[model samples]
Target: MNKKYQVFISSTYDDLKEEREQVIKAVLEMGHIPVGMEMFSAGDEEQWKLIARQIEQTDYYVIIVGHRYGSETEDGISYTEKEYDYASSLGVPTLGFVISDDASWPSSRIDKSDKKLKKLEAFKSKVKSKLVHFWESKDDLHGKVSISLMKTMNLNPRIGWVRATDAPTTEATQELVRLSAENSTLRKKIEGFKTIEQPDEEKRLVHILDDNTRKFKVRRKSDKGRWDDAEKVRNTLLEIFLMIAPTLVNESSSKTIAKEIAFEHVGNNWFRTWPIGDNKIKGMIADLVALDLVQPSKKKHSVNDKEEYWSLTKLGNSILKRARRIQLEEGIDTLEDKSEEDF
Candidate 1:
C-alpha cells in the first residue's frame, strides 16, 4: 500500500462512543487502521502527543460532526473541530460524518452552546466538500460513506463490503456491469443533446468538467498546490515508517508493516486513490519509487495476478516520522489557541 492514504478518525466523545467504536471496527474490517483518542492512554500528555502525532501522519481525516461538539469541553473547542482544523492546515483530505438527529439526537434542538454552534457552522461551511451525513440505522449510510470515502481517496469501492452476503454473483455482476456501461453511454448522449437545447445546463456541465479537469491536473503536477500539500503528508508518513521499521519488521511482512504504520497514523487502508487518469497514477508511483520511499513488491499469484503490490522501504520509514511530527506540532498549536480563546 502507498503511504499517502492514511485516515484519521475524529469525533467528540459525548456523542459518539459506541458508534465511534463501531465505525472504528468497520475501518479495521476494511483493512485500515483506526486512530482515535482511545488509541492513547487517559490524561497523559504523552498520549495527547501521540494522538497529535498520529493525526499528522494520517492521510485522510474522518471527523464525526455531531450536535454537541464543543459543549463537553471546558475550552469550548470540540476536539473533533480541532482535529479538522489541524488536518486542513496540513492539507489533508478530510471527511465529516454528520450524525442524523433521528439516530443520535432525538430532537431538533442541538445541545451545543451558541458560540460553539457558530464555530461549528463556520467549520461546516469551510469543509462542505469533505462532509457527509449518516443516520444510525440507515443501511444506506454505509454505502454513502463508503462511496464518499472512495471518491475522496480516488478509489473504487467495487470490491463490496467484507461481510456482505448479498454480493452480486458472476452473472448478476456481469449484468449490472453491462447495464452501467449502457447507462453511461446513454447519459453521455443525453447530456450532449441537452447541451444544444439548454445553454445553462451546458454551462454547468462545462464548469464541472473544467473544475474536475483542473483538480486532476493539480494532482499530477509536482509543484501544484494540492500536489505539494499531498507530498508534505507523504514525506511525513515516510519518516514515521522509519521510526517503527525495526519494531514492525521483526513481526510482519513489508505489506503488514506498511499496513500497521498506516493504521496507526492514517486509517486502516494504506492504498487508496481517486478515480483519475491511469498515466497520472503511474507517474505518482514512479516519483515515490524514485525518492526511495516506496517500491513495487514481487508478484504474487493468487485470485488476481494482475493486481500489483507496493510497500515502503527503509528510507520511506524516515519520511513518515518527519510527517508525523509536523502533524502533531500543528495539532497541538491549534488546540492551544482554541483553549486560550475559551478562557
Candidate 2:
C-alpha cells in the first residue's frame, strides 16, 4: 500500500495564524497531510496528547519560529517550544522557518514565566541546522517554503513543482500519442548503448576493475533491517545531484555544483555544514565519479591538488532525466518506503 507523507507544523498561533493557514494549504496542494495545533482547542490535555502522537507519526516536522515563540504563560512552558522538544525526542527530521526582521519581531520582551526566553534561545541553538528564516513579505513565499520542505524531506526540487496546465487536452491528444511513440523509439536506442557483460580476460585492468566493484551493498528486508530515515534523506540528496548533472557542463566545478544544490535545497541552514562533515555526502560524490555521472577536471583545483573539481558526463545527464521521471511518478513515496519501517 502507498503511504501518505505526514507533516507536523509547530508555530505560535497568535503570531502566524494567517501564514500557517497558507502553509497548510500549500502542503495539502502538494499532496501531504498537514497537522497543526489549530485542529484542537488549547484547554484539552487529551488533544495535546493526540498532537504529540501526530508528531511522532509525521515524516517531517516544520517549526515556525516567530519572535514570541518562546514567550511563556503562567504554566511556565511555551507551546511552540514544547512541540519542538517532543518532535526532537522522537528523532523526527525537523525544519524551522524563522520570521525575519520584516515580520514584526516582538518588542515587549515579557517573560510571564521564569527564564522562558533563555530556554527558547538554548533550544534554537541546539536545532539551528534545521532552521530556515525568511522575510515576511517575500514575493516568492511558496517557492522558498516549498524548496525548504523539499530539502528537509529529501525530495528533488525539479520534480516538486507541478503545473496545472501540463496535462494533455483532447486537441493535443494526437500530438501526445506521436510524442509517446517517438519517446519509445529513443528509449530503445538508449538501451542499445548499455554495456554488455565482458569476458573475464577482457576485464583484467586491476585498478579499473577494483574501482568498478561495489564497496558496500544495501538490501531491503520484509520485516527487519530496513534503511533508516537518515538513509532516505541521503537518497534524496543523491537524486538531486543526478537531476542537476546534465546542466553542469565540463566547465562547472564541484564547488559550484554543490553551492547550487545547497542554494536550491539547503534554505536558511546553507552555511552550517561548510566543508562537508558527513561521510555519506562524500561517498555520494565518489559514487557519482565511479558511475561516470561526473568526471574530474584537470584545470580546476579546490585550493590545492589534494582537492579536485568534477563536472557531469553524458551518461550522468541521462540518469538525471530518468531520476526526474521517477520522482514525478512516485513523488515522496520512494523516501517514505525507505523510512517508514525504521520509524
Candidate 3:
C-alpha cells in the first residue's frame, strides 16, 4: 500500500521563503503533506503548545538554515531551532539542509546583531555537522530534499497515521501476538527433538576419517591354517576379545587400543608374538558391535581425546559372566591386570 507522510518544515520564514517553497513542492510531489509556521498563527499565546502538537502529529521533520536567525521563544532560541529540537526529542525522523558558507546572502536576510549572528552560526554548525545537505540555491535544496526524503522513508519507515476503519482490530492484534509466541515455542520444541538421544544419519561422526582405510582385521575360524600356528593365533584372538570386551565395549574406541597380550609359545609356532596393528584391532571391535556384545558409548568422544573406552551391552554382560571364567581356564587375561612381570 502507498503511504503518505506529513512533513513538518522548520526554518526562518521570511529569509528562506523560496527554499521552503521548493522543499514543500518536493514534499507535495512525493504525495506527502507539508505543515509549517507559515500555516499557523505566529504570535499566539499558545504557539509552543501548537508547535509541539504539530510535531506530535507529523511523520517527519525537515529543518533548513539560511543567514538570518528569526524570532526567539521565551528560552531565547529561535522558533525554527525550537521546532527542530522538539521534533528531535519526540524521535521524529529529520532531514536538515543549510546554505553553503561560500553562498552570498543579502544583508536584509542576515541578522546584524552580534549575539544573534553567533546563535545563527552555532545553529548552522549543529545542523550541518550531522545528516545535512549544503545547498547554494533553492534548486539544489529542492533536489536534495527529494532524494533525502525518499531514501529516508525507505530505510527508516515509521508507524504513520491510518484511518479509524483501516486500523487492525484489537482481537486480531491479540491473535497475532499469540501466534508469534506459539511460533517461538514450536521452534524451541523442534530444537529439543533434534538433540534427543536418537540416531541421526546426517549428524557428523565424532571420529570422521577422510581416508576410508580399513586397517583393522579380525581372524576367522573358517580360514585354513595356511601359515604356521595360524590355528593357535586364531584361538588366542578369541580369548583376547573375551578378555578386553569388558573394558573396550565400543567399536570406535576399542579399535584404537594397543593391547599387550602374553600367549604361551606352543609347539611349531611360526606366527609373530601377540598384539596386532590398526586393521586387525578395528576388525575385532567391528565383529563385537555386530554381535551386539559391544555398544558405542553415549558419552561425547573426540578423536583427539584418548577415546579407547566402551561398555558391554546387556547381552555382552550376560555372556561375560561365563566367558570370563572360561577364558581364565584357557589362559587368557587382560593386559590391565597382567604385565611382563606376570610372565
| Local distance difference test values of all predictions, in order | 0.51, 0.55, 0.65
- Order the candidates by TM-score, highest first — what do you get? 3, 2, 1
Where is model 2 more than 4 Å wrong at Cα?
A: 70-75, 102-119, 129-135, 138-141, 155-343
- Writing each residue's lDDT as its tens digit, candidate 3 over 1-343 gives 4567899999888888888899999999878889898878655548778778989999989998988888887778888888888888898988988787767778788889999999999998878666676678898788668766765775577876566776679998999899999999999999888855766221111112111223322222223223332333332334444445434333224432333221222211212222344456667567666656677677776678764555667766566555544445545443334456556
TM-score of each predicted structure versus truth: 0.40, 0.47, 0.49
Q: Give the per-residue lDDT of model 2 (tens digit) for 1-343.
A: 2234777888777656767777787678667779888787644556778888778777788777655544444566776777888888888877767555445444653344446557756756655655554545422344345545654454422112234476557879988899999999999998899788545321222223223322221212221223341112233434446434543543343443444444443334333223222343356567667756677665545465454466667765555445544545534333345557788
1 or 2, which is superior by TM-score?
Answer: 2
Flag regions of model 1 displaced more than 4 Å: 1-5, 41-47, 71-75, 101-104, 107-112, 129-131, 134-140, 155-343
Off by over 4 Å in 3: 168-343
Q: Quote the positional error of residue 259 for candidate 2 in Å.
A: 7.1
Between candidates 2 and 3, the one scoring higher on lDDT is 3
Error of 3 at 107 (Å): 2.6
Q: Which has the higher lDDT value, candidate number 1 or candidate number 2? A: 2
lDDT of 2: 0.55
